[model samples]
Target: MSLVKNLLVSISCTTYNHEDYVTDAIESFLMQKTNFDFEILIHDDASTDGTSSIIKEFEEKYPDIIKPIYQTENQHLKGIKASGINVKRAKGKYLAVCEGDDYWTDPYKLQKQVDYMESHPECSLCVHAGYVVSASNKEIQRYSRPNKINKIYTAEEIIEFGGGLFLTNSMLYRTELDRNRPGFFEKAPVGDYPLAINLALQGTVYYMDELMSAYRVGDSGSWTVSSFSTIDNKIKHFDQISIMLNRINQYTNLQYQHVITRTKKRIQFYLLVEQEKFKEALKEEFKFIYSEFGYKDRARMFLQGYFPGILMSLITIKRKLNL
Candidate 1:
């Protein structure tokens, strides 16, 4: 097995009980065709399933490139982020992130991003378009920025987008930025959004229109599935997100105050709706943020507020019909 002498890119991945999907994620990293050497840094947070064994298998096969960190206990439960561990261990010019459930499709994905970042010194981060796949690895929808054209987004815009603007697997950023992480990041509920804001503050963020990676949704042990599992869970998660935004506000010296304020209000409105407190959500204070919702959301809120019994009956019927 040949070892990499000078690593140019470090593929950072975090996994937990991803037995069914972890193999695809690992294989995707190994299949990458790049001129410069790259290392795969996988942090398995005490996976109870076969994920650890599968990772050990890959490490045995590609001993030089695969670096596995096996945890006896799950750090995530201890409020430690597995992603940060891989980021700290990354010793490369660029850091690429792809969680265990997500996989990249294009072999040239790393090379392309590296080439762009190499030429463009102002770009601290580079992200490309990708697909949102189901738990079964079936394509569900495209995960991408709003515009189809490749463009650079400012720090203010990154703050306004609030995280879901780009997929995590598609991210390739400068590793140096993570060395001195800001205090705000520690308080963040999720790492990606705050990290994006942190990077954008350092330099411009580049968005490429190429389709490369796939983000798996509805996967077990994933943040999305767990956060949206119940109304209480959602409220707690959203509250944490709001706190993160406040930290970002302070970190940026309130330069993006207006945007941050609006973003928090939007979250507030969302939380109210999620709690089925439609009367409060429809109040005058949250009225401004109502424009953020779609037709279905508006209709549902109206029904829940005015015709709650009817709405509950409809929900029960839908559940009875298994819809």
Candidate 2:
């Protein structure tokens, strides 16, 4: 409930056990060059590592700019999201997100997004592309872009693409859009995707083809790693996503029924593929979904489904030859 007068943007960051990377994230927020005032609202979910200490160092150095919530107990284990806490406490016209493991690269990133949002009041959210880096911060590649140029995405497109369409740290959206989020958002397993969909529902969502941040992948304690570490967890996550989409469909009053159904089918198709149910995946209904996969992936599926020995032999040879 703390309000900052004339604060243009509030950077909401959540962290847990990110000792090695928290400094980079804090430094990135401090490095932003902007004409308007911005505040950093960081929530430490009782990190077991030295992440809290690092955040404290920055908080001490920049008391006026950094407002952090240090948790004594891990709220995540109790089913409370730290991001939710940060969002409720945020006191900015616009909210930008950068997780503890991610960092912004462009000093003018906030300025650029703020300028666009200010001029274009209809825009609910603005996101840019960024570099995808390894756990050690080595640049792996640029985040995949759905469009070759800057474009505005529709709600249907956002629903169809789901969560992975945009980089999380590159997102900046109006704070009001998040204040009245639908009830389903509280239960959504993934935050960024549902938030984006909600924003798209409100107004225009613009994408700028600018590499303005670095999104770290393969972080040990990251959501992706924890959610996909086991087959059971993977299935559980898929089920959660399915439920979220169903709720979204209801929340939209079935206006986006077709899009939500298509997304659910896509997820179901992946689950079937993961379970190696080739017969089910080859059924007429699911067969069309194969077109979404690359030719190499289709080939691999065929090989795995029919010629397991051959596929294993090829994999063994590839690994032996370091291909």
- Which prediction has the highest TM-score against the true structure? 2
- The weakest ten consecutive residues by lDDT in model 1 span 298-307
lDDT of each prediction vs. the true structure? 0.79, 0.79
Please write out the lDDT profile of model 1 over residues 240-309, one tens digit for every residue. Answer: 8788888878877788898888767766765665566666666666655444333333234333322233
Candidate 2 lDDT by residue in tens digits, 70-115: 9999998888878788889888999999999888999999999999
* Candidate 1: clashing residue pairs, number: 0
Q: Could you tell me every candidate's TM-score relative to the true structure? A: 0.86, 0.87
Which pairs, if any, clash in model 1?
A: none
lDDT of 2: 0.79
lDDT of 2 at 253: 92
